[model samples]
Target: MPSHAPDRFDEVPGDLSRVGAHRAPRPRHHRVRAFAWAAL
Candidate 1:
């Protein structure tokens, strides 16, 4: 029996285009914490 599967490469471009338009928001304190964690 043959199975049908959707192509992932076709779906990825549309998903990335949609998300690329939006800018992510981050709090100042959160940014500071993230940097501190990375330094450790």
Candidate 2:
């Protein structure tokens, strides 16, 4: 019989709320110009 121990288990949460939570949105002009310049 195979037995597993609960005490040896660990729980991890996917928490993105704490990361980059205060970053400002990218400017629309920069995004559009970047692609246009790259395509040339």
Candidate 3:
């Protein structure tokens, strides 16, 4: 897969790309959260 978009976001040019929950993940939440988010 490839992203045509550059590292720079036109709308948020001042902010870096956010690739997370944007916060520390909840403790031991992945077992449930992963399946829910991933539809697994």
Best-fitting candidate, scored by TM-score: 1
Off by over 4 Å in 1: 1-28
Write candidate 2's Cα lDDT for 1-40 as tens digits. Answer: 9987766224334552433444344567987899899999
How large is the C-alpha RMSD of every model relative to the true structure? 7.2, 9.4, 8.8
Among the numbered candidates, top lDDT falls to 1
TM-score of 1: 0.31
How high is the CA lDDT of each candidate model? 0.61, 0.58, 0.56
* Model 2 lowest lDDT segment of ten: 8-17
TM-score of each: 0.31, 0.30, 0.26
Model 3: per-residue Cα lDDT over 1-40, one tens digit each: 8768666434453354544435333458667888898895
Q: How does residue 4 of candidate 3 score in lDDT? A: 80
**Pairs that clash in candidate 2:** none
Model 3 clash pairs are: none
Error of 3 at 1 (Å): 37
Better of 1 and 2 by lDDT: 1
Candidate 3 regions with alpha-carbon error over 4 angstroms: 1-26
